[model samples]
Target chain A: MVLFPGSNCEHDVVAAIEGLGGTAELVWHGDRSLHGVDVVVLPGGFAHGDYLRPGAIARFSPVMAAVTDHAAAGGVVIGICNGFQVLAEAGLLPGALQKNRGLKFLCRTVELRVETARSALTTEVPVGTILHVPINHFEGNYTCSPETLAELRADERVVFRYVDNPNGSIDDIAGICSTGRNVVGLMPHPERACDELTGSADGRPLLRSLLTAGLATRPA
Target chain B: MKFPVLVEVKLREGIADPQGATIERALPALGFAGVEGVRVGKAIRFMVEAPDETAARALVTKLCERFLTNPVIEDADITVG
Candidate 1:
């Protein structure tokens, strides 16, 4: 996973991945190569200090260009919170993140409904299964056009929907899959809510769910 | 080279745009009700051709995702002519 300079959640995400017995390496955002890594995770945090928009500046980082190339090559990219913002800014995903509708910084643990079990991840859960995850952000709303929304629905790319919807999201969307489904960006902090010590283990499956899918896209 | 491009952006809706409505209401008070459809919006302009359509679409979408619009509170669309 690439760590942006201001990423507050990198260590936490590392701990969560480590605690889950998953191997994770933190690569600085400026690194130019994936170093043979099969998947790249963009951990949540205030990249470029969240200046001029949550991740507008971070999208242009030296590492983002490499990340974009990797994602285009079918490498898996998972972004959470500010990471999601960076992905949107880098055009890895669709939509943008903005200040909350109420214009307040929101911090809470919320429930999310699994929209598809067939996705690269979340295949272990049944559709509609709920999981608890934490979210912290001023701009985490998921917005997209009605036409794009329709295309996503028709393509079944909606991966997760917030059950509690801590923030206002179009169609209650909490997570989405890329056109290839291997790339996913979600607002909820699954890494932060992945432990029993965190008082909830609901975020556990998301990390491990796709471990068996074979990292990266299968040979064509 | 003057060419057509599609720019997508979003502004707050009636309930969400306090800035826009403030401007609208103040217009009437300032004797500018002539601007009844006073709503705030964003403009994105670019250039493209048939061969450039796919690249243009992708690039414009990237621009929308990156800068031209915010994905959460704001919505976006593209026009090509």
Candidate 2:
């Protein structure tokens, strides 16, 4: 996990991974190396106080060069919420997240239907599976060019779709992956929903899938 | 020489501007009718050390394209003095 100064969900993701019996560690944003971690996760938060834009400043962090290299090498990269914004800003993802259509910071559980089971985050989950996940963001409306949208759909890169449009994202897309299917970005925070005590554990399948993928790729 | 640069960033045409729309919707109630296309944007002001106005403008444009604005969904109007 890459930890920016303002990252707030590093511990949540750490706890969720540990709860599932997986080891997770934080790599500071100033560090230029990932230390050979199998999976790179950019956890959610208002990094750099969301200055200029949600993820604009954070994208230039030194650790991102390593993160970008990891993704290019076919390693798994999962970006949740603010992490998703950073991914988009860094050009790892194709779209940009703008202000919500309602212009309100939404904090609630939303139903997300798995659109494809081919990506690192959804490999174990069946397509069409509905997961109740929580999304908390002020600027989560995803927008992209028509050409890019067409390409994403054609490549089966869209991993999740909102069961009901919540933030007016184009085509109700809740999450998408790179053409390689190795890098994934989503506005909803699966880490926050991994425990039953937190209202729903529907996120376990997704996180577990990530862990499984990471373990499979771990160097011997 | 140092120049003052201003960059106004606005959402690209066809992209939804919720903050702008909300403010536009509330304008009529305030007796300010006939207001249309009340798009909201931000202006960034900074000083850049450059040789001339053209260089300053070029530098600011580069910043806008790479950092000041997200070309995916925004346009930046830059002014240098």
Candidate 3:
């Protein structure tokens, strides 16, 4: 896990990873280097005061240059909530995170409909399966030009959509992947939902998928 | 003469605005009472060097299309006076 300024959930995400036998590193937003971390995560919170757009100003942070470079080399990038917004702003991913249709800070667990099972991230999840993840964002709506949205749909780039459409995202998208699903930005907090019966445990499958992906890449 | 054009960019009806909320929370401390319904929007003020309002509107539209809003989530209204 990387800690950007204004990030309030790094510790929790780190704890979740730690509980899962993974070490999470806190990377400050000011640092320009990635420091040998295998996976880069942009945790949720308000960054650069969420100016212009939710993640607009933060896209220019010195650390992002390295992040973009790392992702270009097929490194995994996971952005949650505001982190997702930042990914879109950085153009590492297409589309934009718009304000939620209700115009309120919605905080609750919602069901996410898994749209694809091909990505390394979603290899553990079956397509069309419903998983519960807590979403606490006002700018969780995903939007792109109709042509782009259509193309994404045609290309299987859309990995998930909120089953309930909590936010008025284009085509009700809640999660998306890059061309190869190597990089994913999700508005829901999988870290917050990794435990079943805890209301957040529904997120464990996604995290579990990360480990599964790492294992798949290990030397045979 | 400088004409002040209002370029209000409000979150599309239901967009979440944490920045606006943070500012609103501080307004009471700043003695801004009766400031109800304070939804923060972006107002960009730029002087257009066009020959006339029609040309200005066209340029602004292009700017809006290419840069201002994503066209999928936001709608920009360009008015020249």
Which of the predicted structures, 1 or 2, would earn the higher TM-score when compared with the native?
A: 2
lDDT of candidates 1 onward, in order: 0.76, 0.93, 0.78
Please give, for residues A1-220, the per-residue lDDT of candidate 3 as tens digits: 6666788878878878787887778888889998877778898999878866777777778899999987887777889899998898888889888667656778988998999986656888899888888889988878877678888899898888888887788788988899867788899888888666576576777877876665554434
Model 1 regions more than 4 Å off: A214-220, B1-81
Model 1 lDDT tens row, A172-197: 99888889887888898888877787
TM-score of each: 0.76, 0.98, 0.76
Which one wins by lDDT: 1 or 2? 2
Residue pairs with colliding backbones in model 2 are none
Clashing pairs in 3: A99-B15, A100-B14, A101-B14, A193-A200, A194-A201, A195-A201, A196-A201
Error of 1 at A191 (Å): 0.8
Task: Flag clash pairs in model 1.
Answer: A96-B71, A98-A139
lDDT top scorer: 2
User: Per-residue lDDT of B44-81 in model 3, one digit per residue for the tens?
Assistant: 77777776777777778887665565544566656567
Give one digit per residue, the lDDT tens place, for model 2 in A168-204.
Answer: 9999999999998889999999999987887999989
**Fnat for the candidates in order:** 0.33, 0.94, 0.33
Listed per model, the TM-scores of chain A against the true chain A are 0.94, 0.98, 0.94
C-alpha lDDT of candidate 3 relative to the true structure: 0.78
Q: Cα lDDT for residue A148, model 2?
A: 96
TM value for model 2: 0.98
